[model samples]
Target: MSDAHVSLRDVTKVFPAANGGEGLHALGPVDLDLGKGEFFAVVGPSGCGKSTLLEVIAGLTPASAGTVEFEGWRVDADIPDGIGVVFQEDACFPWLSVEQNIAFGLRKTALAADAKQRRVRDVIDLMGLGDFAKSYPAQLSGGMRQRVCIARTLVTQPRLILLDEPFGALDQQTRLLMGDEVLRLWRQTGATVFLITHALDEATMLADRIAVMSARPGRLIDVVQTNWPRERDSRIVERAEFGAITARLWKTLREESLKTMALKGAGQAAEPA
Candidate 1:
């Protein structure tokens, strides 16, 4: 049996003329798929629409052309039911305790109170936030707060998780720890993860496959499989294989980044028509 989670076929996004001039081409005309239980990361130059792609797939933003599918159906702006999203911003609610935040996703459901408590408790322990279950977001450190954000998303047991730079604000060491946590959750829940990250090392370290994008009007330049041991830790950074993949990731990133900058420069230098 085949298990494809999210599929984008010739998906393109174009922003309408901002100052009544010309529209901006954002992402796609790119085709890609993230399989079930797969950890896929997208990396590209700034403004390459990495987050746009995630948004499109999540059905939060509409694509101008083509299709975004989840679990076999086209997800064209209606929020899909089985997908969980964690963004870069502070998602933890200041007023809610750790347990309360984690249970937020299930509030609409009719589950019995005891069942809800068990689900919340399980995710708290799963995320290693059991110790702080009673702590509020304001009382927690940055990393711990992010863990709460993630646990909140996971408590619903979504089949697919879309992470948009969920660890971008953290320090390098903290990001590594969070990457480990994400992998652990993926293992436990068997959820497909589609992540957008700018850090090449972070992408290389955490992704099962890395999708590299080009300049604006982002296209799938290539997809490289990590296949570097499923059970990984931050210590893997010291190994030679990690260096090899990360170096290659940088090579693609640098080339695409330069291309985008050059295009931007030329566009700015040209007089408006």
Candidate 2:
């Protein structure tokens, strides 16, 4: 991927053990490259270090080994300038209104007040939250709040956006609708999106390519290209190829999941009573 917006080479993360014995090996030895303006996603079983992978790419967490680079710059110890991260949990400021929360990240920028406001307004309209600009997190539904979170990230005009199951808490219908919103955002903003999700359908519908990982001590097992057009929406799921893509993702993921469950059972069986 010559136009790689984000690149990882042999990236791995291991959590130090409190007893100074062994560590919990979470991720990789994985190599991945996300192209500029591409919508890429990662899907894996629970505890497979999917979130760890996202955090490493975002520079929120350091990798024990290997390198992560974004847009030709090595990223270590600090988040790169052109990256934004949205996690599964709600991060909106409780005290701030929708507009204020969205503008919070821009405060430290060199842009003038009018410019900041304009950017915020543009994102608000993009996310379809114009009606709720005055509303707070408590006043919005789950899907709407997630949109607000994404809107906040978009206001900064990041070149790469990393989303960790941002729509995980929403209902199925809401998740599909929010997928459409994300598609619109991706098309309009032309930003590279790196999403980590457990939902095969969502990944199938939204991503240009989907990477599957093995169970903990996570490894990149496969990458499936959706082969959909850049200008696409949730309705594409109704197409035959959508089902085939989702099934392919599931096939690999299910194997990993079963292996994960067997490993967990074996671990429990070996534990002291």
Candidate 3:
């Protein structure tokens, strides 16, 4: 982990109570080091602070305690320059075409117009969105629109990509296809990817290592190494090892998920009649 691209030391997040109740302990005391140019995924039960962990790592929300460092540099109030983030929600500008939307973030950079155009064009091709360059988000299918969102981030050439269920909204078939697209993009860009997902199959297929978390006060419960070859594609799932890996990931998460559900059920039962 000495050559880690992103390192977290005792990172934790606690949201203060809205009323006079105790603060919600969302995430924490996590110590993980994601290697440079590798794909890592996190899977856990619902309401297990998965998104909170991603926000803290991205510097979008401040951690209540501990520190996050990117390539030895401490992440502070602002998101570091070499990182890009994509969320589950569709963020594409409806009014803008695919190419225009991809170029949006580049406007804040000092790159020349021609350079910006080239960058956008390259990412469009990379994400296989060349056919829909002029199409707006509404004109594209769910998968294509997600590609646009990812392309928009890639156009900026970030060294680290943090994806929080980028394909969460798509159907299963489309989700697997999008996973192929992501694998291609990850190999091509050579950027480190940190993904947060709930799908065991997705995590098993895409990640070099999958981290499973505990219930509400989310902590890393287990880390399963996929040991997938770097040159692999989606077809690898056909292998028996894939099922074993997914089953292992689910095994670690199933207990935590039951815990989460029971806690919710109790909370509901305790509410005033």
Candidate 4:
């Protein structure tokens, strides 16, 4: 639909095999629609092309077939200003301080210097980094570093934010805290959030809907909607309903994971579904 913030129809990706010829189909014939300002998650086994799906949506990589559109415009390598992306790694540059890194994306923009700096300060405050705005990445803890990365993306004022396993490197406690932080940011920003993660609990807690992908030649096998309130917290997992949702996610993922392992063992590509 035209109002969809993001859309992917029959999207697919393939890579040439190491020895050459025919190539390995890694993902798709996937169809997805992300509504304006919705929080969505994609989950699957390790080699199931979760990141590939995200990158295609981000315009970081081209889809081998089908279409990707954002706000009725077809997506290409040139991502529009309305999009922001955060990967699993802490992408903060060593030479840049917290505020400087957050403002980096605005470097080539036409915004006035003071206005650009104001945007950076706003995000730092919003992310609870007011104290560390002048500190370098080396001065922060892992969780704090990730917060800086997120602030950097937020400062860009993106309408659609894509995160690929953004908290995968954090400790369990920190991951929970970061997840809460992400939700708060989402509420404040009202961006369409698309997160990719292997943690079923994370998906259950943060996603309005979660799509489960099948084995490589990845296809979205199912999409599960949750009833979590818009204002989410880590404690949501304490609810019995949360456990049920996570259990269902695990059940869908396990079958695909076993199939992927078997195919890899036999030196064969997973058949496209």
lDDT of 2 by residue, 9-56 (tens): 999999999999798999998999988899999999999999999999
Q: Per-residue alpha-carbon lDDT of model 4 for 36-125, expressed as tens digits?
A: 989999999888999999888888888899999999999975666688899899888989998889999787678999999888888888
All candidates' lDDT scores? 0.88, 0.91, 0.92, 0.90
Q: What would the TM-scores of all predictions be? A: 0.93, 0.97, 0.97, 0.95
Candidate 1 residue runs with Cα over 4 Å from true position: 1-3, 18-21, 263-273
Q: Each model's RMSD to truth, in Å?
A: 2.3, 1.2, 1.1, 3.3
Question: Which prediction has more favorable lDDT, 3 or 4?
Answer: 3
Flag regions of model 3 displaced more than 4 Å.
Answer: none
Clashes of 4: 0
Model 2, residue 265: C-alpha shift (Å): 2.1
Model 3 TM-score, all chains together:
0.97
- Predicted candidate 1 versus true structure: per-residue lDDT over 210-269, tens digit per residue: 999898889989888889777776677898888998888888889999998998889888
Residue-pair clashes per candidate, as listed? Answer: 0, 0, 0, 0
